[model samples]
Target: MKTLTVFTPTYNRAYCLEKCYHSLVRQDNEDFIWLIIDDGSTDNTKELVNQWKQEKKIDIKYHWQENQGMHGAHNTAYKLIETELNVCIDSDDYMADGAVERILSYWKKYGNENVSGIAALDATIEHQIIGSKFPEKLNRATLFDLYNKYGVTGDKKLVYRTELTKLYPYPIFQDEKYVGLAYKYYMLDKQYEMLLMNEVLCHVEYLPDGSSLNMYNQYLKNPKGFSFYRKELMKLPFGGKVFKYKQAIHYVSSNLLMKNPKLFIETPKKALTVLAFPLGFLLYVFIIKKTRTEVN
Candidate 1:
């Protein structure tokens, strides 16, 4: 069995898939498998992967399924991966020169059943750390501590034990009203503390087309989705205590003020003041405009 399974779920990202494929082929450690879940791409994704598969440079597995969104691809990846540890590398992202080697070495030296997973640094544009580092010795953080300390931003930074990861399939929702795959890690945090590795392992390219870059548009298009996100987040095992009502109020108010300004105008004055504080409203508008400009 492979020690690690590195998977990518792609939909219409054929242009950048080769970078991921080539990087995997050059991994210092060969005890890893690549699982590509093609989320119903009409592009040349299948042909691209198939050529690589035929070359047999690395252990590659490919699956084709109707596009169910990111969470759906995650659900499929979890079920299919048989390795002890799993990492999801976005199609647009690639691993650093010796990332898999370093990850394997760390796991062999420090990993055990008690350690739920390992965390690594992710480099965004210009190969810089996307954010601040989590403090060392966080091998036993509660769900709240993970978010408060690590900020719970990028999915690529985490490597999960396959057993624990498979336990939480994406939660079913009442409406297609939410953003992509925000709550799964929160669910995972309830079950385990992630081991922190201060080294940079993944290079994450923050394309203007990336989902996280379009928060304002997503909010405007799907307030119901944000509401559903809040509801589902509250359902996590440790949700209520970790993510209190204040967080929810802050998130909703900020999003509305940025995406749906008219809705902010309609909010009751007292609640609005509490949710959208003095600088919060200004920052929200500024960020939205800046991000939209970047996207354009």
Candidate 2:
């Protein structure tokens, strides 16, 4: 069995997915399996992955299923992953050179049950670190604190233990996709702090089609999913008052979008939710207007 599984959840991104494949082929360490979750793509994704599988240069496992959105694809990936460790390298992203070797080596030296897994830097293709490197001399911190406390900004790559990743599956709401993937990470944060590595493990590209680029649209389309995530975040034990209030604001907005009358009743932080109502309603209006403008 491989030590790590490098899984990619892709929709109809076969055009640019080849960059990820070639990067994997160039890996200095081959102890990772590439699992592709084809989330109901209409394009030639199946054909492209099939061709790569036949080449036999690296281990590839491909699974196809109806469109259930990104979280649904993630649910399937967790179920099928057999490795001890796993990292999601998005279809539009690729590993930095020797990233696998670096991850495996660093983990071997400092990893243990005390940590959930490693949290490493992500860089642009031009090799600029997405944000400040992990706090100097800080070895471990929950994902939430890394931002709220340490002031670390921008996206980072996460490598998690398979057992932990399987624990909190994102809820699948009918007709809605796009639950914030951070929901599970924050849940894990309640129990474990991650080993912080400053090395850039992955290079990311934010295409127009990528979810990050169109979040207001996602916010409108996935109200139920976002509502569920916000409610859960409000319940997290670690987040501070302001953080919880921010989640409450989003929670209120999502419920308002759903037209769920019991917004206050459904909230985990009722007081915060009440306090956040004005801002949340304003945010709700802003989202509606913003998305509507984009559409028109």
Candidate 3:
């Protein structure tokens, strides 16, 4: 089996997906499989991928399913991955030069049962790091500490054990399509720490249509998904009261957006939920106003 499975979950992104494909073809190392999860594209994405498959320049696996949003596509990827390790490279993103070789080499040296996998850097198309690099002396840490305790910022690339990624399949809400992808990472944080690599693994471009760029709109459209994510975060064992309180604020707002009556009752931290009510209500009103203004 290949050492890594690099999966991309794509919707109607065929226009930009070719950039990701060419980058994979240029890899200095060919010891990885490219899995494309086609999330119900009305475009010519299937034909595009079929041409790439015929080239045989690299191994490719493709699966097409009805549009279930990003998190649902992730659910399918985790289920289908047969490799020991897996990393998600977004449709509009591509691996950095020599990234495949770097990852396999690093894991060969440091991987063991004690850890889950590696957390590496991500960069912009202009070759700038998205956030601060890992602390020079730091070796391993859970994804949570890399932000909360260490003062690290911005999005980082995560390579996780396929077995672990499969453990927390994201829940699918009937009409809602947005769920914070960090839900699974935080769950893994409870069980294992990951080896940190400062090397850039992927280059990301946040398109206008991408979820990261349109979060307020996502909040308005996917209240149940957001509410469920916030509630899960509040239950993490390692997160402190302050962290839980912050989650409560978002939780309250999401519930309000959905008009759920049991906000306080459903909250994992009831007192914090009560304390967070004022701000949460304000937040709900602000989101409503913000999206409304955009619409007009």
Candidate 4:
């Protein structure tokens, strides 16, 4: 088996997906398999990937399913991955040169059952770290603490053990499609600390259609998923009070978007939820107004 499964969850992103394919093909060491989870694209994605498969430059596996959003595609990716380790490279993103080789070397030196996998850095297309690199002195940290406490910022490249990753698949909500992907990472954080590697693994591009750029619309259309994600964040004990309160604020906003009557009852911290009401209500009103003018 390949050392890693580099998975991409794609939805109508065939235009930019080639960069990902090219980068994978250029890997200095082919210690990885490319897994593409096609989330119901009404485009030429299937044909394009078929052409790549015929080339046979490297191992490629493709699965197509109805659109259930990024988190749902992730659910499918985790289920299908058979390698001991896996990492998600967004459909619009690609790995840095030698990234696969570095990851394989790192795992060989540091991987063990006690830890889940490596948390590597992500760089922008211009080749700059997305945020501060992991602390030079630290060798490992839980994914929760990396953001919640240790001041690591921005999204990082996360490689996980397939066994543990399969255990915390992101929950799929009925008729909803925007759960924060971090839900699974935090759940795993409770069980294992991630090895911190300071090498850049993936180079990211924030395409116009990507979720990060379309969050306002996501907030308006997928309030239940957002609300569920916030509730889960509030329940995690490692998060700071301020962090939980921030989640509560968003939770309240999402609840209000859904016109949920039991917002306070559903919130993990009632007092904070109460305090966040005015702001949350304001955000809810803002999202409504914003959605009205946007065609998407």
Candidate 5:
């Protein structure tokens, strides 16, 4: 049995999925399985994966489903993964040479029930580390505190215990497909802190069509999901008042985007929601204006 399942949630990314496959096949170690969760791609992704399945260079498991956005695919991935540990590598991204070996070695040295799993590093194809190294002299830190409290920057690789990842599953929103993936991570933060690994585990390439570049469109189109994520953030036990209010502001904006009539009444924290009104309304207006600008 493999120690880790490296899953990629993809939708219509056939053109670049091969890079990920090539990278995985080249891994120095074979202690991990690659799980590809195809999120309703209309392209030739299935055929490509099927072809790779025959190669037998590494373990490849393909599961396809309707276009349920990234969170839905993540949900499916978690449901299917049976490994002790797992990490997500995007369809457009690939792991570094020997990255699997590094992760395995690090976990073998330090991983235990007290910690979730390794929180590793990410680098670009050009070999640039995405963020600062984990806080010096830190043995463990929750995902939220690493960014919010210690001021760690950039996206990092997250390898989690399969059991822990299964506990805080992401919720599916109707008619919307975009939810902040961190909703589950934050929930996990409430329970466990992650072990920081300084080695780069994955290489990232941000495509033009990626979610990072089109967040405004995501906000406009997926207000319900965003609102749901924000509401959940407001309820986290460890985050401070300012952070909760920030979430409240986004929650307000998402509700406004959906034009929900009972926004005030539905808020979990009315005072924060009330205080965030001006900024939230402004954000709603900005999103509308931004969309109009793009259209014109």
Candidate 6:
């Protein structure tokens, strides 16, 4: 059986896909399979992947499907992966040298039914850590602890057991959503803990065109998505003080600030900063406009 399955979900990213493929080709470990979920790209992405497959540089599996956004592609990848461990490498991002070998080694040493997955360091340009640090020793980490205490940020550098991952489907959204099915792993903190590998596994490039970079601006414009996210977050088994704190912040910034500015005028937080930081509501509108122009 394949020990690891690395998949990339991409759309119109043919230009950057080769970088990811090269990273995998250079891996010290070859005990993995590569799967590409092409989300209906008009670009010659299929041809590019085919060339690599024909060369036999790596075992490759390709699936092309109708465009249904990132969540849709992830759902397909989760269903089709047959390896013991699965990790997602974005089309625009690539792994550090020997990252796959290290992951497989850690899995062989520590991975078990009690462990839900593994987390690693994600770095950005100039070698700055963009996301949470992997703890040196394994410990029970709650989703709240993962976010609030450790400051879990980006989505790269996560590997999960194939069986546990297939249980949750990505949530459907009417608008652009911030968190995808990835939150399901956090929800599993109710039952299991993730192993931490203290190494930089992947480098995440922040493009002006990436989905997450502009999401805050969208959140400012359509606070309804924030309401939707909070509602879904409340449904998790770990819903409590920490969740409420984060949800309240999300609600106040998204719904109360933009959707109902009048409420802020009627009743404000006791702390002035709380009321001030969404930028007095008017400034947020200006910021959103500025971001739209810049990102677009």
lDDT tens per residue, model 5, 239-293? 8999998999999999999999999999999999999999999999999999888
For residues 1-296, write the lDDT of model 4, one tens digit per residue. 77799999999999999999999999999978999999999999999999999999999999999999999999999889999999999988988999999998999999999999999999999999998898888999998888867889998999999999888667777888878988998989888999999999999998887889988999988999999899988898777788888898899999998989999888888999998888888988898888887874
Any idea what lDDT model 2 has?
0.94
Task: Kindly list the per-residue Cα lDDT of model 6 for residues 1-296, writing each as its tens digit.
Answer: 88899999999999888889998999999999999999889999999999999999889999999777776788899999999999988888988889889999988987789978887778884678876564555454654557656666655477888898887676655554334454666567767877877688887897776777776665654465455555456456665655554554554555553556554443323243254445434445665677778768
Lowest-lDDT window of 10 residues in candidate 6? Answer: 264-273
lDDT of each: 0.73, 0.94, 0.94, 0.91, 0.92, 0.73
In model 6, state the lDDT of residue 153: 69
Give the per-residue lDDT of model 1 (tens digit) for 1-296: 88999999888999998999888888878999999999889999999899999999999999999876677788899999999999989999998888899998999888887767887788874877876666666544543565655575543478889998888576434434234465666777766676778888888886676667767666544455454455455455554443544444645544554364454444433353345454455555665687578668
TM-score of each: 0.78, 0.99, 0.99, 0.96, 0.98, 0.80
Off by over 4 Å in 4: 293-296
**Worst lDDT window (10 residues) for model 2?**
264-273
lDDT of 1: 0.73
When 2 and 6 are scored with TM-score, the better candidate is 2
